[model samples]
Every structure is written in C-alpha cells, then in structure tokens.
Target: MVSRKEVAERAGVSVATVSYVLNGKPGVSEQTRQKVHAVMSELGYKPSYAARALKIKKTNHFAVLVHYLGDPFEAGILSHIEHQARRHGYFVSFQTYHPEDEERFLQEVSGRIDGVILLGQSLMPETLNGLRSAGIPVLSIMEPMQQSEWITTVDMDWEAGMTQLIRHLAEQGHRRIGFMATGIPRHPHEQRRQAFRSAMLAEGLPCEEEDVLSGGGRLEEAKSAMKHYLASEAARTCTAWIAANDLMAVGMLSACREAGLKVPGDLSIAGSENILMSEQTEPRITVLDYPRKHIAHIAVDMLVAIIENKQPRGCKMESRLLIRGSSMHE
Candidate 1:
C-alpha cells in the first residue's frame, strides 16, 4: 500500500504537511494542496480507515441520511449541516436510501462514522433499534417520535408558521382560500398541512376536501396535479391557493399561466419555505420563511453535543411568513 510517508517524500513536503493536506485542513496553501493531491494520485495512496480508526481513536466524521434528495428545502438543511460539521473538525457524508434498503444502509453507516443526522420524518422502530445497538447516536431534524429519550431532535414550528400565513391572508380579505399539496401524506413531520387546516377552520373559512391536492413533490407532478384540480369543480369557487412548499407553488404558477390565469389577479398563491428560487420567479412567491440555516445549526449543535457526551437542552427556532406578489393584492 502507498503510505503517507512515500507521498510526502514524492511531494517534497514533510509528513505533517502531507497529513494536513489529505485531511482537508485549512493551513495548507492552495498551491501546496494541489501538489500534495498530485502526489497522492500518482502513488495511488488511499487512507486506511481501520488503521486510522484504531490510531486516532475516532472517526472524526459523521453522516447525514436524507429520504428526499430533490427537495430544495432539504438541500438547504443539508448544506448547513455540512458547514457545521466541518467547523467541528468532522466531515459530513450524505446518503440517500429507500425504506426497503434502510437496514442495509444503517449497517454500512455503523462502520463508517461516530454519529448520524437524520432529515427524515420518522424511522422504523426496528431501524432505530439497529442504530442503537450499533452505538450510533441519531439526531433527527424533524418531529420527535416515540424514542425521544433515545434520540436527539430539532424541528421547525411549522404549525405556527402556516397559522400566521393564513391569518395574514385572512386579514387581506382572502375568504375563499384553497390549500394544495402533492405527495404521500404519511410523512410524520407534515405539520404544514395540519396548520393550514387549523388556520382555515379557526377563521370560519370553508375548506373543501377536494381543494387539498396530493402528491406534489416534483415540478411536473405538481403542475399536472394543479391543472387537474383547476379543471375540477372546486376551482370555480376558490380564488387563492396555499401550497405546502415553494416548489409546488411555482408549479401552481406555471399551471395558472398555461390556463391563461394571471397571478394575484385571477388567482393567488402562497407556499412554505421562502427559498432563493422563490424570489427569482415572476411576481415572487409568498411563503413561510422557514429558518433553514438556523434549523441546520441547531440540529448539528445537538449532534455534536451528543457525540461529545455533553447534555444539550431543548433547542427551537422560529418560522415566519413572507408576503410577496404571488399571494397579495395591492
């Protein structure tokens, strides 16, 4: 096997310099970093995980498992997690797995890192048990499940976020509001839907069962779903639409354009998670400004605390509603 010493000699740098470069430390200059990388490639050098695990007595690494990879909101959370992990002298690895393959991935994860950050709604009890037996602490970034004592959790107050959004719209005279969502309704952290329901009910606003569309994760899926919903009988009565996320709201806007509908003139749209893309669209989308950065920071801090054996208190963040051209009439 090509060793670090050999690479260090080939690069004409000290062994310590080679170590710093390979481990992604910041002290090495870009030029030196490039030279060290070249030496590693030429020598076919690969770091031995088992040897390092035994010598350093730590992996100095963590993993983040996400179920939904395409969602921008989820991506935002992940970016923040990675930043926090790097700051704590640990590298973050991301893995996407289906429910059927979760057990296998958990097995692989056990051998790879000291801890895990889950951006999932819930994990099967069996999977939780497997992780626990492996001595891998999990920090879940959504709603807390039955194993609150066994796992660390941090989540956005989605219910309050959406409640405030509805109240804002109601104050603006949006009486005939419509709610739309696309995707399976089984996610354990689906507080946005519940909040929308409660808000509409509290205002004595009518919520038609048909107005709540399902299966809306992808752009095309939401576009098709919204188009079909518009053709349905409910569209004749409802004038405003509240999407559970910004991506779906963008799709709704596209569907409206296809049907020759003008936003905020013929219909109004609102969504959750005020991502950057939301502002780029024409007549920017009104959405619940979820604290994506704050969410990532808190979740990571909790994970680090657990890894370091430090007791972390219950941490929480707030979500706000951002009014924009898509959902307001001025």
Candidate 2:
C-alpha cells in the first residue's frame, strides 16, 4: 500500500537513493542506507517486484524443471533453491513433466521466463538444441548433461558419492552387494550406477547384474520393483544394497520388512540424498550427503553472472558420505 516516494521523502533522500538502497546496489552511503531502511520500516513501504523487473527488462524469475514433486527430499531442495533465488532479487517457478511428453514441455516453457534450471530430467539432444536456438541460458542440477564447450552447468559429483559408499560397504565385509536405481534417462543416477559397478569390479568383486533393480524413478514403481527384488532368492545373498536415492531406499526398507528380513542385521542398505526421513527411521539410513543448497546457490550465482553479462568462473558441486545404522556392521 505504501510507496517508495513516501519513504524517500521521509528519509530526506532522492527516489534514486531509495532504489539503490532497497536493491542492495552499491554507491549508497551506509549511513544514508540505514536511514532509508528506518524510513521504509516506519512507512511500511515494500518494493514492487513487477516494477523493478519492468524498469530493468529482467524477469528476476527463473523456472526449475523436474519430472515430478513426489519426493520430499527433492521438494526440500526446491524450497532451498527458492529461498536462495529470492535473496538474490529473483523468484523461482517450477514445472513437472513426464519424460515421454517431450512436446508438451517444449510448448510450455518457450518464452515463459528469463532462464531455466533442469533438475533430474533426461537431457535429450533435441531439447538442448532447442534451448540453444531459443537463446535461453540453462543450468542443469543433479543431471549430468553434455559437456558442451559453450553451455554452463553445475552438477553433483555422483561418481564421487558412489565411490565413497562402495568403499564404506566394502570395509563392512559387503562383497556381493546389490544396487537399486530409477530407470529414468538422467545422467546423475546413471553415473552413480556406473561408478558402483566400476568400484565393485576394481575391488576384485564380480558385481552380479541380476542384483541391480530399476524403479523407473517413481516412488510407487520403486516399491513394486523392490518388492519383486525381495521375492527373489538372490536378495538374501547380498549383505548390502546401494540405492540411487533415499526414496527408493525407503521403499527397499519396507520391502525388506514385508519379506521378514532385518535391516543391517540381515541386509544393509545405503542411499543418496540424505533427506530428513532417513535419520528418523528405526535403523537410520546411511546415505551420500549431496549439497542441494550449495547446488542451488551456485546455479543462481552463475545465472546472475550470465544475466549481467559478467564472465563467471563456472562451478561443480561435490557429494560426500554420511554413515548411519542402516549400513553399519555390528
């Protein structure tokens, strides 16, 4: 309801000064900036995002594209991304797409915003080509996209995460370990699966192909896959299993119970994305603590730099292991 003009008048400063102070721009004296803040609080004047965006011809709004919002772990990361984007004078929008509905996604995103962030979705060659043609600067998180010389990207090092998990499992005397992953075409999980295979093979262990199960990356699908996996005799042979994400691991844990197996007592389970639910369970899940907040911050920081036409040193995020009762050996 209150306007910047009223705040400026009350602060005894020009409108331009108020603008600079409100936007956290440089060139305003700290003393005057404090005075402007006091006046703003007193006047209860809030800046209009629409006005700033219109004047600057920048949306200050970015869209995050994912497959779905079913996973609470991913939802938490999205919440962090939204908070970080807002702190930098930007807002975030989200869209969920089916991996098969490629045409719908392209139709929906064209010219809708200033930039886009792709998370955990398949990087089709055509989609990347289309984005390039449209001139929309895109940054991918969690997905390992093509390392094009021109496009900028920030991704979690899944190989590093899995290597840590594999080594930990090996140390616990888990020679014949199983693995579960989503069947989606994204690169991050695929890289983790490959890393698991490579790590196990290098350790003089023949990782059984039948031990790997596909969840299709959906929670219900993961549950079904895990159920089938547990029904098999091979499930009891492996002392441990590595899941691509905590969601599938949770499903696996449920399946283990339904099959009358004890966690870590009969079978050990490890997962990625150390979400909140992981720690609360009876036998807490051991997981890879991928830095979602850091990923969001780094992506936005890169987007801002690219938007301002500033040459930024692009970045890559790293992941680490967090041990818990789910995978610990007694």
Candidate 3:
C-alpha cells in the first residue's frame, strides 16, 4: 500500500499538509487540497481505517437490525437503505436480528458500528440503554416506540393505511372482511392488527376472532395456512380478506387457485407493503404501497444526522392504496 508520506512527497507538500487535507482541517487551501487528493488517488493511497477511527471517532459504517431477509419487502427497504447510505459516503451491513442474544449482539456491534437502524422492530428498553451507553445512535424504521424519546423513528401511518384499506372494502360492498397475519411479535404488524380491529369497529363491520389467521410469515407458511383455511368452514364467513403483507396475499391467491376460488368473484384479497412480486402475481394484489425508498431516505438521514450530531429530520408518512385486480367493487 502506498503511504501518506509518498502521497505528500508526490504532491510537493509536507506530511502535515497532507494530514490537514485528509482530515479536512480548515487551514489547507482548496488548490492544495485538490492536489493532495489527486496524488493520493494516483498513488492508490488509502487511509488506515484504524488510524482514521482513532483520529475521528467514527467508523462510517452502520448496521441494520432487520427481520426476514427472505421477504422481498425487507429486501426492498434494505436495498434502498444501502443506496441512501452509499450516497451519504457511508457503508451499511445488516444482521437478521434474533431476540435470544440481544445483549451479546449489542455488545458485539457497539463500537464497531457507528449507528444501528432497527427495521420494523420495537425498541427494547435495555437494548436502547446499552446502545446509549455505548454512544451509538439508533434509528428505528417503525412507529415511534414507547419510552424511546432518545431514538429516532420513521414510518408510514399504520392506522391510516389500515383505515383506508378497510374503507375501500366497505365501499366496495364487502362487509365480512378477514385479516391474515404472521405469528411474530413484530411491533409494526401488531400496530397493524390493532389498526385493523379499530378500523373494522369504526366501519361497523364484524371483526370476529375466527376471521384472523395467525401463522408463520413466510410464503409457504401462509400458503399452507390459507389452504387449510379454504378447506375449513370459517372460509365461508368472509367475502374479502386483507393480508399482513403482499407475500401472504400471494399465498392466499395460490391457495385460491388450488381450491378453484376465483379472485373478486368468490373471495377478494388485499395486501400491505406492495413488494415487487405483488404486482407481478396473477390477477395482481391490491395493496397499500409503503414508500420504501422514502422511508430508507428518512431513516438514513436521521441516523446519520444523529451520528454526526446534526438535527434529525424525523417524520411519518402515509401509504397509498393501490386498487388492483385482486380486489372487487361489488
């Protein structure tokens, strides 16, 4: 590796001037700074990460604690987050978070990462305290967590999205609507379930315990659960159903295909977080489009701001409902 001394020598500058330019110190003139950078690039000189970290107290790397890497929704959000992070001259890595080793995970990532972005997970008090003590800023890409005043959060309105979906079904003359959810303790999905119940009540529609299906959050699990639902007597009770996500909605569509149930004719289904596959499905899924790019932009902006001691631009957004062939206007 080429040394900073060689870069300084090639650029006709002292080592101190090269150090000033590398550190962005104010004393270096723009012309000299550009010349130093050119020489460093020409010599393929890269600063030592360890030395830089000691000098600046920053790693320029962030980690995202996410659930379900297999899910396209999370994948989409992560891709956008990476894009945004790169635009900000930062690097992003992700870990599939498990609750079992919470403290150990925190301890492992504490000093190595500059910030942590929790995607669709509730803020645990102890975890927050640990990160706080470690001096690593945190941002959650979900609804505001309770007892989490210090952390930043960004999300689309869950209740509003649910309300719009339920209202649309109601306007389409569907009274008995069911909800299919994943059997996970995801805080945002819990919020969505509450929103579904509340919206059903507000619409004066029947919200029965039998109408909700709770199982795993994978496509195959949803499909298997839905296949059994189609075989059960409870399937006759609802004319339309809303899934926790588009993947589940597609699973329902798959089940319907085997059971010979025509979408919008026998049963209507709507989904959340219009993942890329949601649109490409047969008959297509009607869904509430969560703005992944926008959410990523906000989450990255807030987390980077907090890491850099800037004011966080925290905000909540609205999801737009996309009516597709899978939904019916009866």
lDDT of 3 by residue, 113-208 (tens): 888888876555556545544556678786524445556678778778999999988888899999998867644566677778988998789999
Q: Please identify model 3 stretches exceeding 4 Å from their true place.
A: 1-56, 143-147
Model 2 residue 43 lDDT score: 70
221-319: candidate 2 lDDT, tens digit per residue: 777887887777755778898887788888888788778888887889988888887777768899989777877788788877666655455566677
> Model 1, stretches more than 4 Å misplaced?
1-57, 144-149
Estimate the TM-score of every prediction.
Answer: 0.77, 0.74, 0.78
How many pairs collide in each candidate, listed in order? 5, 0, 0
lDDT of 3: 0.79
Instruction: Write the residue-wise lDDT of candidate 1 on 117-160 in tens digits.
Output: 87865666556545544456778776524344556678677667
The CA root-mean-square deviation of candidate 1, after full C-alpha superposition on the true structure, stands at: 15.1
CA shift at 3, candidate 1, in angstroms? 46
Best candidate, TM-score: 3
